[model samples]
Target: MSDRELRPLRSIRITGDGRCLFRSVAYGACLRRGKHPPSDSAQKELADELRAKVADEFVKRRGDTEWFLEGNFENYVRQMRKPHAWGGEPELFMCSHVLRMPITVYMYTSSSDGPRIIAEYGQEYGKDDPVRVLYDGYGHYDALQPSVVRTQSRL
Candidate 1:
C-alpha cells in the first residue's frame, strides 16, 4: 500500500506491572462497550474491577474441571485479583471466557517472520467483536488505537 493509503497506527501504553495485560484488555473492552470511551483514570478503575471479576470467574471454573489449574486455586485467584500480580496464559484464557468476547493478542518480534498472533481467544464466539490487544515483544502490553486516514483535501 502507498504511504497515503496506509494510515499510521499508534499504541497507548499500559502499565508494565503485572496488571498490564488485564488493564489493556479492560481498556479495549470499555472502548468497545461503553457509550463513550472513559478517561484514563476511569479506565484504570474499570480495569481494577475487571481484574477481580475475572479472577473470581477463574476460581469458580476450577471446580468444574480437574487438573485445570496448577497450585491452590484459592491462592491463585487471590493473587490474580490483586494489582501487580503477573497474569499469564491461564488468566488470558479466563478473561476471554468471562468477558464473552474475543481477545486477540498481537506479538511483535525481531524475527524476519514478522509479528505474530500470540493468542486469539473467544474469536469464534464473538466474530464480529472488534476488541483486541497488542503486546510489545518485551514484557508490556498496549492498546491499539484505530488508525486515522487523512486525505489530501484534509491535509
Candidate 2:
C-alpha cells in the first residue's frame, strides 16, 4: 500500500520492559478482535502467557524449527519461556503460529517516506487481516491501529 493509504496507523506505546514485543503483540491481538487493549497489568500477564505459548510452539514445531534456531533448541526454548525474556524475529514468527493469525510489522521512516512495512509473518494462515505492530528500529515495539476518519456532514 502507498504511504498515504497506510497513514492512518496510530501507535499505542508499549512498556519498554524486555517483554515489549509480546506486549505489543497482545495489544494488537485485542484490537484485531475488535476489543479494547487491556490494562497494563493485564497486558503484562497476557504477554507472559503469549511468551509461554510461543515457547511451546517452538517445541511443537522443533522438527521444522530446530535447524534455524541459534544454539541448542532446548536452551532457546527455555530462554523464551522466561517471562522477562526479550523477543525478536524468531519469537514473532512463532507468535503467528501460536495465535494462528498473520502479523504485519511496520517501521516509520523519514517524514517523506512515512511508515513502511518491515516484515510480515503468517501469511499462509490468512492475509485478509493481520495484526499490525510498529517497530521503533531499536528493541521496542508498539501496537498500531487504523485511525477512524469521520467525515463532516453539511447541514
Candidate 3:
C-alpha cells in the first residue's frame, strides 16, 4: 500500500516534545532477542519474515507518524550466522526514539541493567521517569504502552 495509506498511532517523547519518540516499536523482537533472531540458523528465515511482516504492518498502520527501525537485527544476524563462532545479543529494550515522537521509548539494553533499573524506579518511572532509568518496569509491553511510558518517563 501507499505510505499515505498508513495510519499513525499516538506517540512522542515528553522530554523533547515532538523531537524524540517514534510512532511505534518492534517490541516482539525486543522480547525475543537472544532467543530468536535473523541470524539463528533455525530462526533466521522465520525471524526475518516476522520482522518484515511486522515492519509492513507498522508501516501500514502507523507509517504516517514519525518512525525509525532501530534494533540489533543486523548485528544479531551477523553473530548468528558466522558458520563457527556464533554469539550475539538480543534486541535492545531501551535507548530507541523515533524523530517524531514525544517521549523516549527504550527497550533497555543489557548494559542498562533492565531489572535493576525497574526495581529502582517502579512502573511509574517507566512512564515518566525524568531520569529515564526504568523503561523495562512498565508492565510488559501490553500493559504499559507508550502512553504509560510517557506518563512515567517525563523529564
Candidate 4:
C-alpha cells in the first residue's frame, strides 16, 4: 500500500531481501552436511524481532481480516521452519481479519469451495469484490522456478 492507499500492480522487493533468502537457502543447503551452519549475514539479528513484530501486528489487525501470500508457503514453512522462521501453523498469524491462503491442490478446510470461495473471502467488497482465488494453483517450489512463470504468463 502507498500513501494514496492504492495497491500496487507488483511488489517492490529489493535484491538485498533476495540475498537474505538466498543466504537462508544456502544455510539450508549447508545443513544437509549434518552440522550447524555458520552465519554469513547480518539479517539474522533483526529477523526474529521483525517476524515477531509482523506476526503480532497481524494478530492485532486480524479481526475480520483476510490475507494472501500467493503461494503454497504454509506447508513449505512447516517443512523448513528454521530456514523460513515461520512457526508450523496455518494460522500462525492468527487474526480474525487474516484469512490464510496457501495456493495448493488442497484448500484449507476452513474455506468454502469453488468460485464461491472468492465471494466468501472477498465479501468486503459491495458490488465489486476485491478478493480472488485462482484454484488448482502452483505449489511452493513450483513458483520459484522461471519456467513455471513463463508457462503461467500465457494463461
Best by lDDT: 2
User: How much is the lDDT of residue 74 in candidate 1?
Assistant: 80
lDDT of each: 0.70, 0.87, 0.27, 0.29
Tell me the tens digit of each residue's lDDT in model 3 across 1-155.
21122212222222211111111122222322323212223233443333334333444444332234334544434443333221111111121221111122235566743322232112232333221212333322211221212235667
lDDT leaderboard ranking: 2, 1, 4, 3
The stretch of ten residues in a row with the least summed lDDT in candidate 2 is 1-10
What TM-scores do the predictions have? 0.78, 0.91, 0.23, 0.24
How many residue pairs clash in all the candidates, one count each? 0, 0, 25, 10
Pairs of colliding residues, candidate 2: none
| TM-score quality measure for candidate 4 | 0.24
- Residue 149 C-alpha lDDT in model 2: 71
Which lDDT tens digits does candidate 2 get at residues 1-155? 43355467888888988999999999989888888888899899999999999998998999999998899999989988888788899999999999989998999888635568889999998875588888988889988877777889999
Which sections of candidate 3 miss by over 4 Å? Answer: 1-39, 67-155
Whole-model lDDT, model 2: 0.87
- Top model number, TM-score: 2
Candidate 1 residue lDDT tens string, 92-115: 777788788878777767773433
Least accurate 10 contiguous residues by lDDT in model 3: 15-24
